[model samples]
Target chain A: EDKVVQSPLSLVVHEGDTVTLNCSYEVTNFRSLLWYKQEKKAPTFLFMLTSSGIEKKSGRLSSILDKKELFSILNITATQTGDSAIYLCAVALGGSEKLVFGKGTKLTVNP
Target chain B: SAVISQKPSRDICQRGTSLTIQCQVDSQVTMMFWYRQQPGQSLTLIATANQGSEATYESGFVIDKFPISRPNLTFSTLTVSNMSPEDSSIYLCSVRQGALTDTQYFGPGTRLTVL
Candidate 1:
């Protein structure tokens, strides 16, 4: 069975703090790893990492994957209160387009 | 990116009742996905709905309990039958477009509360 595990189910941090979220997975075939920020009912796309060692960035947020170790990390720099939300990690199955998701990391940013 | 919409953003239904949630995409899509997120839980795939074939359900999900309809490329519906309090959850609709690695976009979701 394919599974995705995320660390620090919940985190509390003050504004301007930097935090790192982790995701490790085990699947039959590796395809792609995706990160999403879900503030409410819908999850917005953040990054899709398909290669190892390369980093994908968007403003204050950045992510990188290590395929050999089968894990990924999402880093937020100078985090703001607005960045407080559930960060989800998902892996796309090799043969199928199906996505297996992690329990998610709930980051709480306080001003 | 696709603009997706879901009907009846939230509903309170009586036990044993049924409710059908609608999902509409701005553009035609090849595959649509239905998911359920239980309270405090991550999203779980309920099924994959295709335009010209029967919907494929994931493990722990069956067609009879959660029937799906894909009448066209731009629309689909998921019906929750014989609801119970345990069935209360947020049902989300999603679509994948563009290249093979394209991320799936989700609808606002329907929040169901069974009493």
Candidate 2:
């Protein structure tokens, strides 16, 4: 069975603090890992990682994948209240478009 | 990425009733996906609707319960039949660049509350 697990189901932090969200998976025929941020309803695309070591960054948000360890991390530096949302991690099944998702980490950045 | 939209942003439905959620895309797409998000839970794929074919439902989801229709390239609809309290959830529709693409753009989602 394919499974995706995310750590720290919920977190509370102050503005200007940095936070790291974790995601690990167990699945056959690995394909790719993706991150999304859901503020209210729809989740917005964040980063998609397929190779190890290589990192993808956008502004203060960055993510990296470790295929060997079957895990990935999303880092948000200089966090602001606008960054408060539910961060979701999903892994796509190889040779298929199906994605297994984790429960997500809810981050609340207090002003 | 495509501009996706869903109708009835929020609704309160009574038990034993039914609701049909419509999904529309700004551009033509070969495939459209329907997902369900339970309260405080992750998203789950309910079915994959392809034009000119029957919708392929995932495990634990049946066509009789969640009927889907793909009439054209840019439009699809999912109907929740015989609604129950457990059927209350947020239904979202998504579309990717291609059939093999993994990145998907989502709709705002229809929040259904069954009472």
Candidate 3:
């Protein structure tokens, strides 16, 4: 079965602290891995990693994928209260449009 | 990326009643999908709505209970039939543009509260 697992289901940290969220997957013919941030409504696209060893970054948020380990990690630097949300990781299989998502990490950044 | 919108952002319905959620995309899309997210849980794909074709449902989801319609490329609807408290969840609509990559955009989602 194809599945994505994220570690540290929930985390609480103070503002300005950095956090690293982990995602590991076991799927057939993996194509890409994606990260999303959900605050209240829909999840907004954060990063999509396709090739191994290549890092995708947006401001304080960045992500990378390791095909050999079949895993990915999302790093957030200078965390803020506004960054508190559920971080979701998903893997897209080759030849399929459907995405298998992890349970998500509920991050709470305290001020 | 596609800008998707869902009607009836939130609703409270009684048991045994049914509610239909509408999803509209700003631009034409090739594929649209419906998903259910229970409180504090991950999103689960319910069905994939293809333009001018029948929706393909996932395992554990049937067409009779969760009928879907995709009359065109930019519009689709998902009807939750015979609702119950357990059916209370966030119904989301997603769309993929060209390729089968990980670039699926989602709508704000409709919050259904069955009482």
- What would the per-residue lDDT of candidate 1 be over residues A59-79, giving only the tens digit for each residue? 999999999999999999999
lDDT of each: 0.94, 0.93, 0.94
What is the per-residue lDDT of model 3 for residues B1-115, given as tens digits with 9 covering 90 to 100?
A: 7789999899999999999999999999888999999988899999999888889999999999999999998999999999999999999999988764668899999999999
- Please give the distance, in angstroms, between residue A63's alpha carbon in candidate 3 and its true position after superposition: 0.3
Which pairs, if any, clash in model 2?
none
Residue A16: error of model 3 in Å? 0.7
Model 1 scores a TM of 0.98
Candidate 2, residues A1-111: lDDT per residue as tens digits? 999999999999999999999999999988999999998899999998999999999999999999999999999999999999999999999876687889999999999
The C-alpha stretches of model 2 lying farther than 4 A from their native spots are none
**Which regions of candidate 1 fall more than 4 Å away from where they truly are?**
none
lDDT of 1 by residue, B1-115 (tens): 8899999899999999999999999998877999999999999999999787789999999999999999999999999999999999999999998546648888999999999
Model 3 chain B lDDT-worst window of ten? B96-105
Ten residues in sequence with the least summed lDDT for candidate 2 chain A: A92-101
**lDDT for position B58 in model 1:** 92
Note the DockQ of each predicted structure: 0.78, 0.81, 0.83
